[model samples]
Target chain A: MTRRASMAASLVGFGVSVAAIFLLPSVLELFTLINATIYVSMAILALSLALIWGYGGILCFGQAAFFGLGGYTYAVAAINFGDSTWAVVLAMVVPALFAALLGYFMFWGRIGDVYLGVITLTMTLIFFKLFNATAGDAYKIGKAALGGFNGIPSTPPLNLPWDVGSPLAPEDIWYIAASLLVLLYFGSRWLLRTSFGRVVVSIRENERRSELLGYDVRRYKLGIFTIGGAMAGISGILFANCVFVSPTMFSLFYSAQVIIWVTVGGIGTLLGPIIGAIALQMIVAKLGTLEVIDPNVVLGSILLLFVLLVPKGLLPLMQSGFDRLRRPKAPVPVEPAIRPTATPAARRPEPVSAPVGSAPATNTLGGS
Target chain B: MDLAVVVLLQVIAAVASLVLISIGLAVIFGMMRVINLAHGEFIMLGAYAVIYATRWGVNLWVAMLVVAPIVVGLIGVVVERTVIRFLYGRMIDTMLATWGLSLLLIGAATMIFGNVTAGVSAPLGGVTIGEYQTSLYELVIVAIVTAVVLALMAVLRFTQAGLIARATMQNPAMAASLGIDTSKVYAVTFGAGAALSGLAGALISPLSGVVPTMGVAYVAKAFITVISGGAAIITGTLSASTLLGSLNTLATFVATPVIGEVTLLFAAIVLLRILPQGITGKFFRRAL
Candidate 1:
């Protein structure tokens, strides 16, 4: 399939998913409206990381930093503005701005990929520590007290755009979450179809080659990183509406869990992370209720099994199975060659035979 | 004068701990070019080995000095055989895989030894330095670190096994062509690195205690030290540890531990910005 056709197919698939979500309350009576809303929010968070890591080839170990920042910004802004609409705007803007500044220093400085991981992890720890230490009554922004580790309680939920007095019902919130997910999903697909997305993917393939081709690699990287931060911020806003924002939002565990979701879902696809997040989270929630086995053991085992046995993840596995059924003889291998107009899967078959010592196209390791 | 002496001791102790934690990572990451995100877990395993050994009627010294390294080294060998052997050249994949390994180790440890922090009291007591008293164990750590560095230097510089290990790291294909059994060398080198980490963990257990998640705290600092140290393993690790470690200790003395940590991270950022490849990458080009 051509890139345009594949994208169109994805858009249709996304529409179907959105429709299913809208019709879920009646079809699936077991899931509470509030619980479904929370699941949608988690899926959005997973999609944020999937965009940056899977497509941009930038593995951010501290996505939760931007995520928590968004939540805190929304909560604090809501207390001051006495409205959720403005709070949501601040939530996205603040994290995007922060990401832009951080990405400027990091990308322009030309920090290697390994160090990038370390630096981002440090940033998350810093945020976690900073928030955890704000237990005193003095750490107040406007009227909302930063309750340290205990976290801010009873912050206002999303209200109607014009009437601040009337908050959205759980059902309304679910609809909003589902709608936002569909919009963002299609929006990202559209963005990836643009020329700028091609450049970003090219840079991810080979930074030096892209630079030689006159692309400003750092600028493109910074843009994608900021967009990812904004996406994470949006997820945070949905999260704050679902559950109260806490310091745990910035924890390393959440950051690791996001990585797991993206990896399990398959990194390079739009829909993979959403499926991974919702599916794994439901499994985790189920495991939590079963008191016999420790959830960490199960999670750790799953992660190990996936990394070793099925590194390409569930979506790719399913795709490959489907492709085999369609055409049994010619199994296409995914290669990281520069194929600007080809669909992602179609680009996979060509061996990435770049010059020796040149950057591996699929590798994000950075630096020799 | 006494306060000055105590502060100097603290600085030396800080440097010693940094070196001990990072030397293993330098070997595995710097020499092998395999990013072992599970390096911290190896240290954690070492700490647990010492604790378990002592509980099972071994002497504290024996448990720390002998059992911990041996136990963790064997575990490292098993890990290398099963997981790391397949991921030699793929740096990022190795990182992801090892990170998964780390989580597994942490979970397993938690299962075996609940979620509680365990520890042994610092031995040899405190010694008076004019006005203030400091742990004698701190001085012991400094001495031990000095010995470990010297021993590592001697082995790498003078021994045949060291030459083969170095050869394998520099060019595995060439080393294998020379009938050196490059795979064995890689496995041995990784085990040695893990043993060093285990030793460091056992040595520090009295101060920090043993916890399944304790590796998280040490891993970041070790990565910073090793990365800032650069390509040359010994000189890089030593110089980087001294610079970052002293700065951290001095900052702690001046303010709080939190400020000290923040200062260390800021210092690393500034240092990396100035010298992107690291301290040794620029200066100690010939010193290995």
Candidate 2:
């Protein structure tokens, strides 16, 4: 029975993926290919957010910083090295390294959650401001010059090792993206199922408890953060190849939008964010058919509604509802028996007081 | 001599406006623990208010007096109740939610008022201070922000409500135990922060043309100011503002506007690295 259920689930997941790949292009023409490519890039970004938030429980408000870093790094490299695959590798590697260095300093120095959010956010702002200023400068990393505000333009496309002759066409690019997405999805799933993955989840659930269990919490966080950064770097490489790289990629607005994407999709679930990216983009494409509504307004309204109403994300909500419908009806609906009885108030769990700086906020307040 | 003085006035005016908004943000953050990402949207609303009022033929200063704070404060309260209430304690969620909210507001504003930078006329063309003929309107912004800051300091020091706010910020449970309504203080403080941002927007609209995207610039600077001033979580947001304003004026007078901005951000980050607690901790230690 369990084997049947697992097989059914995998088949359903595969059906959904295949439908998305084939139908996405039919509804929107070749634009879907471009859209999928962008979503793939966004998925890489979502992975970064998921790793930081879902596993480490560090709410980074500026994953775009790393995304932008990877993008600019790739763009600069591409411009300099012409379209060398090796250059593309370096482009992605540089950002991952940079994120690792950033994580190292931040994690080791013991910047608590709030301050860590701020530090990363500040880096985002600083990068944009710096890059925005550098736009006019004749600064060249390799052969490519930093265009500053105008951004690097007309950069050569990626040169894959096995093109099988001609450059990777639009349809081919879509296939590449779909395949990469599949690999990442499965890889992330496998990673989370590992012992280290279990440790990461436990850290998210209770950092202090994990530390008391003698796990080096910061090292684990840094490792996962670097992985997230690498995923973002890979996404950036794909993004640079898809379209012209620009400074706007590094902007806070993009960073903020990426966070919204992860939230809209559901953070912890591996496949959820990809669903979110594709769903939101498709909705915007459909809205594009209606000439009246501005795309920004449509996107903004939907995102606002989703973030406010469906914070657990659309995918998770749908999955649970689907599971409910599929399941056999119980003779009596479980209520009190489902939840364990509340522990005695007198023997209440001690308030896990964080170091004044690291204290998990009980009250919701917006900052970074 | 004239160019130098005009540039100086421009610098002072810009810095002063930034300070007022940042200080307002700092105080709100100090009291309520909200970063208020939509603070810039409040500024945008204020600018629109002044613009609409000006079209209605109201005296600029009088219109600002009647409109900015009230409009901004009302929006603040509505937001506090509708959105911000859900965000308390979940800082990351709040940040992302407010960011989404800001995008919604900006998109709505863009749809209503096309994508264009609209200019508002300064009430007084120029007011002469000694040998310097400065824009009297710009100086007025500086004066208003200064007066407001002073009033806030006095309130925080003496008023019972202010004391309660300070107490709640320092120790929420203790304040609650003493029957102080900390939640009310948080809501009110958030509203007040929104109002300051609006006021700053209205005042600066004359010097800096109002645009939907203008909020982006202010958000970054305000964050920098908050960090630099180290104002009791959020109180000193103004101090960084004032300092940055002065530094901005000095930089622009000596070099280019871009250099001034770059320098300010660079200095702020450096300051952040050196003094984690910011200027507040530097000036006065909060007793543990």
Candidate No. with top DockQ: 1
Residue-level lDDT for A271 in candidate 1? 75
Best model number under lDDT: 1
Write one digit per residue (lDDT tens) for candidate 1, span B175-252: 999999988998998999999999999998999978999998888788888888888899999999999999989988
Leading candidate by TM-score: 1
Q: Candidate 1 regions off by >4 Å? A: A2-8, A26-33, A329-350, A353-368
Please, what are the lDDT tens digits per residue for candidate 1 over residues A197-282? 87887776677889999999999999989999999999888888888889999988889889888777776776778888988888
Q: Write the per-residue lDDT of candidate 2 for residues A216-295, one digit (tens) a residue.
A: 98888887888887788777777876886777777877777676676777655555666677677677677779757666
lDDT of 2 by residue, B144-175 (tens): 87788778777778898778878888888999
DockQ metric, candidate 2: 0.35
TM-score (chain B) for model 2? 0.89
Model 2 chain A weakest lDDT span, ten residues long: A335-344
Error of 2 at B126 (Å): 5.4
Q: What TM-score is obtained for chain B in each of the predicted models?
A: 0.98, 0.89
